[model samples]
Target: MLKENKYCCEDHVDMAFDDFLVEKETFPCLEKSEDSKCSYCNKKAEYVLKLPS
Candidate 1:
């Protein structure tokens, strides 16, 4: 069981979520990142992409 997570900024969350859907074959659960940074642009992450382990 591997837990996967990706932090995305508001600007790129849509694109990142789209990719996540394609990869996971289902929607990812969105959460607040708090202090996490975006994996794409390194901006302060506003969305956290997570899937069950």
Candidate 2:
């Protein structure tokens, strides 16, 4: 898997999820990382978004 994107809030999660779902068509693995920023915002990321490689 690859850390495709990072999300700080649920609002931004849906867009990433939809893109992932369309690309992979499966549930993704989740993780949390340190010092990572949200892919769609300036806030620090709370959830690590992984996409199957």
Candidate 3:
């Protein structure tokens, strides 16, 4: 199943951190679409930030 990440404008500017109940093989959930729109605001994303834990 395609997990849906909870998006909060206050927490981030672009894509939100995916709260995957299951374990993922990858890290740094940040992403960008071809349209260049902010996944949270639907506006132009200033930049993409990748933070891995």
Candidate 4:
């Protein structure tokens, strides 16, 4: 599944999943805003995943 999505094994799956959910909630603006940054890395859209269609 990950291979089909072009995700590397080292990528954190959980983080990617969370990013996907966020993206779905906010379609046009997939980047995490100042109010919605990752607690661990404080990065916006760093660990993004392509949701399954």
Q: Which numbered prediction scores highest in lDDT against the true structure?
A: 1
Candidate 4 error regions (>4 Å) = 1-11, 26-50
TM-score of each: 0.82, 0.59, 0.30, 0.31
Winner on lDDT between 3 and 4 is 3
lDDT of 3 by residue, 10-53 (tens): 33542354432233434444454333545466665544434454
- The CA lDDT of each predicted structure is 0.86, 0.67, 0.43, 0.38
Q: Write the per-residue lDDT of candidate 4 for residues 1-53, one digit (tens) a residue.
A: 22222121223446545554564653222232333334345444243234444
RMSD of each: 2.3, 3.3, 6.2, 10.4
**Model 3: colliding residue pairs:** none
Which sequence of candidate numbers ranks them by lDDT, best first?
1, 2, 3, 4
Lowest summed lDDT window (length 10), candidate 4: 1-10
Residue pairs of candidate 4 with colliding backbone atoms:
none
Error of 1 at 1 (Å): 8.6
Residues 1-53, model 1: lDDT tens digits: 43488789999998889888877787788988899888889999998999854
Q: Give the TM-score comparing model 3 with the true structure, all chains together.
A: 0.30
Q: Which window of ten consecutive residues has the lowest lDDT sum in model 1? A: 1-10
lDDT of candidate 3 at residue 10, scale 0 to 100: 36
**lDDT of candidate 3 vs native?**
0.43
